[model samples]
Target: MDTQDIARPRLSEEDWLAAAYEMLTESGVEAVKVMPLAKRLGVSRTSFYWHFTDREELLEAMVRRWEERNTGNLVARTEAYAENIAEAMFNLFDCWIDPDLFDARLDLAIRNWARNDSNLQAQLDQADTRREHAMTNMFLRFGYQKQDALIRARTMIYTQIGYISMQVHESKEYRISLMPGWIEVFTGSRPTQRDLDRFLARHG
Candidate 1:
């Protein structure tokens, strides 16, 4: 190896996790083994031991990172203050449209991983419940009754889940066109032109 290659910055845990996440998306959970990751990083397998105890540990770290980043961001957006339910729901549309904020690819990859593992499925279940509760709280804060809020929250979340699972393809313009109707269905109130304008400004 070149001296310059030997002198490259040492890999960190985040480096490994980032590579693992990429492998998870491009390949699958099964492809996230240590040797492959090390190969992908152009490092020795022994280097992995410096950051993680084993493959399982690295997988756990990946899940934790996903939960903190994706799920946490969703909840934060759901709880962001809005002048009304319409605006609050629009805030959440940010999550759907913004890959940096809520990685739909990673989310779908993890869900596919959970299919055969009961333990991972349990974790996914917990995340789903937490996210639903956050949406419900948003509706409740907007003065929706408890029952109505819960139902609307489920509708919004489940619809998104189906969209991801089905791998539905639509142009941004097409999806944006449907947002006002979606907001009406989920919030029971039509978004004014201002609401549509604000959402378009950010996501259009």
Candidate 2:
């Protein structure tokens, strides 16, 4: 009707979800309410209703997005083609360094949120299992025996989880410096210079 009204950008579903994700990362799920998110976006609270039916629906959508982007994408990358297990290790390492592929902030926030909700906790557990299985299959594809693949996969996945849970802060250089040794420990074979170079070209 007015110039100001016309000038206000029409909000999309993604805009509300993005704001909610920021709040969830900053202050956990309980802080992801409609009014606060609306205020954060500088839009009317009614705008959210057009995108989400209620706060619970918004929360579910956030969880679904997390699953699709983080867990689903990670598994897909892990299963990507590699000449050997060492190259496969590098493929999976991309997930750790690439925020677009795996968001540590969102992952940690959801884990924290799960501590208080049984339903969410179950969902998190399922996701963890799926990830572990995917990693195990990667090793299996590289000719590991079933038992060995399962153990190695558990070791790799759990170590990453520990890094996230402990909130370890280290420069990327320092972290990448440890990858060679870590890959050896997880896969039972040292990374070749070519493997190291490939990883560094992307991450270093």
Candidate 3:
């Protein structure tokens, strides 16, 4: 083999998936074909088959990643230990700002893709239910009535979804400035200075 052939590196499953994810995020699902991914990765298209059985499988894997990262982390955050309801609220809110805990871009991409696919839309609905249920239980643990917890949970999650859908952009400093008011609006109590300080430290 020539030196150029020896120098070429093989693409891994994650490499292919990462490329596909970029396409999905940038140009929507229709742009996530194997050929485009191969071109973007500078590898032969067959490399994708080494990891995924087919294009459908790749798409399914993307959805699974979304669920595991976004939904799973949100649920876990709702279950995190806190001294008070305000602290707990900030724990869950961390998902909105932390990319490691939540992928807002992937969430938006999946939601846009789901618009044309009933099956995907159903899955999206189920994920929303799961997140809302977790947050509702969180409020209930903090002494909210069942009905109150449920409505508050819905309002909190729906507002985040609305922000994603509208592609709203705000500076971190500006958003953080409003967290105190938003916490009161969602949880019926304003956070203490200590609670806000703790939350800011985490994000900062």
Which structure is stronger by TM-score: 1 or 3? 3
TM-score of 2: 0.93
lDDT of 3 by residue, 1-204 (tens): 334324578777898889988999999999999988977876667777779999999999999999999999999999999999999989988887788899989999999999999999999999999999999999999999999999999999889999898988888788888889999999988999999999999888
Please name the candidate that would achieve the greatest TM-score relative to the true structure.
3
TM-score of each model, paired residue for residue: 0.91, 0.93, 0.95
lDDT of 1 at 122: 98
How does each model score on lDDT?
Answer: 0.89, 0.89, 0.91
| Better lDDT candidate (2, 3) | 3
How many clashes would you count in candidate 1?
0
* Alpha-carbon lDDT of model 2: 0.89
- Model 1, position 10, has a per-residue lDDT of 79
Pick the winner on TM-score between candidates 2 and 3.
3
- lDDT per residue for candidate 2 within 110-184, as digits (tens), equals 999999999999999999999999999999998999999999999988898898889888788888888889999
Candidate 2, which segments miss by more than 4 Å at Cα?
1-7
